[model samples]
Target chain A: MALSIAGAGRNALTEKAAWFSESLARGLKVARAFDRDQPKMRISEVAAKTGMTRASARRYLLTLKSLGYVGSENEWFYPLPRILELGYAFVSSARLEEFVEPILQRLSEATDAAAHFAVFDNNETLCLGSVFSQKLFGFFISIGARQPAYAGSMGKVLLAGLSDTKLEEYLASVRRVAHTKETVTSAAILRREITEVREQGYALNRGEMTPGIVGVAVPVRNKDGTVASVVNANWISTSSIKAAEIKRCLGPLREAAKQIEMRLASGAVPTGWVSRER
Target chain B: MALSIAGAGRNALTEKAAWFSESLARGLKVARAFDRDQPKMRISEVAAKTGMTRASARRYLLTLKSLGYVGSENEWFYPLPRILELGYAFVSSARLEEFVEPILQRLSEATDAAAHFAVFDNNETLCLGSVFSQKLFGFFISIGARQPAYAGSMGKVLLAGLSDTKLEEYLASVRRVAHTKETVTSAAILRREITEVREQGYALNRGEMTPGIVGVAVPVRNKDGTVASVVNANWISTSSIKAAEIKRCLGPLREAAKQIEMRLASGAVPTGWVSRER
Candidate 1:
């Protein structure tokens, strides 16, 4: 079958060369045209946004529609819920949520603050799961949102887990643009902060990612003791819940992380990580 | 760009033809391969399940990965949280959740029963949004899951909204396989039930889909008075909440559905409908 041929050929060095060909690149950009701010677009709008011809935009949009990732009505185009299957499949199969959701829910109930689980994706940290607290004015971390690895509590926790050489390389790739006055913009400052996070077994960010958002995070370790992920609790700065208050919740947080680690160690895969070659 | 080929040199007929081509068919299967039961799969698993070669799966996976829908590490694949962007983009842009979520949340809070918002996807009803009740042991409904349009409360509500001819066509397509003893199997019986639902402006499913699970649902109309969707509240028989108790919550549900209609009328586009023409 063409599928086997494609699969066997993927590992070949020559296949990598063909993989990045213009057609695939164009196809990707077409898919990227859909985002939170602009979920629906007309054919002309798609063409303008994607910098492709109207004819081309229509083709890609129709192709995507046929693929069930894109949907349309009249002349306006929009994405579909089935598109989530792609991502949900990755996360659910790994049992990441099964391992972590209960923990986060329990932590939220205990700490009365929003709890989040995040993992590193390239140079940024992406929220994988979150359980919002009952408080009216608390952390509102949207799942799938990204934050730089040097400023937010979740980011720092994930950064602290990275190998030193990889960390250095990442730091060099992107400028430490300050998100707020409290954000550490210097590489030296962030490096030191990450090192301290590794030493203290936790990370704290006070209004760095967003004003009034303060969070404390602890690393979730694998059986090998490598930091596999980070879990955090977020609260508002006005709640009198300073870093110390966040620290107070660390016991339960650590316990939850340990529980998740045990589950993952028991052969439950982490969410979003699918074993392909095996 | 090659994207232009999707729509170029094609009239409406050819465009429709392109919608069902082998490439698009394979892509749809790949997308469908991710579901609640199997959220993530290895390349070989995807290949096996979708009848594609591992190479074909890799290409599609890599293509999706580059588009930020899929993420990979060490040859292990997983879905990214950003993939929710697709589902959210569809739901949010359609403005269905803006009105529906608050209402569902309120209903769940009021009755302490699980509430869900669903819409017709061809012959099936797909969950667009959901809110679990504060009470324990309520029915569980996950976003993006699909159910037969002839069985569940939400499904009946949507079916009641369909044009008579379309409804008849759909009824004829199913084998009326009983999921539970209470499930309606005869076309004559189902047609009668649907007529009653249309007349009463609501639908009820008493242990039709899952034994001991009872649900009540109402149709949500769009600005044009077309049945745009349905909202349902479900409870277990053990809860002692009879179908009447569920029906009492319809006032709030209808109010929320109206709000959703208003939002959609104000310019929210439905996100899941595929265009007949490319």
Candidate 2:
């Protein structure tokens, strides 16, 4: 499996604690087994995917259904809208949406592109908040959207924030896909690009994830100088003027990052656990 | 105490099954304990809030921390952004945001007010999607935002959809707080308003939730004629002309609801479990 359990490398005492509930972990894993690709699954498929017994999977699904997180019809089970509360619990508590959204709105409107703030999660770019350009007929990336860490600009910027050993482990484990002809699938090239992003303080993507889309991203650093999150903007790529467009967005994206950094430092946004320091 | 388990009234066999994981439920309940009001909590507070023994609460918290769903500093624990994946699993699987956001955008643009689509979630209005008014200075309601069912226009519209027994149970259990001077605290008054909403096929609120906001909502029905969701719009209340302003928005809000219903029936938006059938 390309996706490993998050935080599996935590210190030994925590993992071996008698208080740890394996059932809770397994249940959560079952709930997460559904995504864009497999929105609905039978108990057997879930068991196979999560490497759990069918009986165990059935119990988890039924429990989720009882909790209103999963809905079942016959043998197929899918997640329900009520499941959003789990994510909402975090977003609302952190109050990140209130603090970061207006900045994204302004950034999107000014750049004439979709603006997003994302964080690194299990070797993927997890979009925490997003704002669409006022211009009609644009792409959509909803909050909680995830993308491969090796391809898109936001993903690369987040990857650049990781420690060297963590970065190497990610590159070694991730199953890379060539989403477009321009996507860099080689680990060596990805390492080099990430190094450049680290030096330049920004990452740029031109038709890497999607054709004809220019993505620019910069890290939003914490007070302690660790990358807390990444702020990004996406433009519809024009073959003749891609560089100019990317250049135009960098100023706003960096400024937005600084604004977010200022907010994070102000103590109003409680991102207590978002610091990725190992 | 007002927030009961979402589907606690289900049939017997599912509850008695040996496969059900009580630890998972308790852990999820612990995670949910941290909200806007209590963003960070100590072990004793968690135990007190969730009605669990401190030892049990400690186990769940440690388990969650290990899974990366939670972070702790000293004795206080808060949810991490990674916790969002639990909710994103459902949102991405349903693809509701992609389908409904454009509709909300158009509604917000036309009405010059914040537009939202919501459903009844445990006696609260759960905003599934939202779009803010482009007029630059307006309210913000993020997706997963919840409001009391007895207060807001959307809440009334959703309450009107519930069965007689369900409605009675909800009224009996909910602890209503008057958010503003105009807020209705009397159960009899709320019942009258909800009955009127059912008859009129729409709901209107003037400074009920917030002092300066006027909210209008209409139900979106499924093919089976069950209320699947509610679409609503909010305008800044002009005291003397509130009635006329709400009247103007009714046409657009009802139209938006119809559009959502049409799209839902077209099979493009799969709302498998949203039918709210008893």
Considering every candidate listed, which one attains the maximal TM-score? 2
Clashes of each: 10, 0
Candidate 2 lDDT over residue span A90-198, tens digit each: 8899886688888998888778888899888877888888876667445667887888988888989988988899889888899999998889999999999999999
lDDT of 2 by residue, B68-89 (tens): 8899888889998889889888
Per-model TM-score (chain A alone): 0.82, 0.89
Instruction: Give lDDT: candidate 2, residue B179.
Output: 94
Candidate 2 chain B, which ten residues in sequence have the lowest lDDT sum?
A: B1-10
| Model 2, runs deviating above 4 Å | A1-17, A238-241, A273-278, B1-17, B238-244, B275-278
lDDT of each: 0.69, 0.83
lDDT of 1 by residue, B195-268 (tens): 99989888887888888888788887765577877888787774434656856877776776776667667655
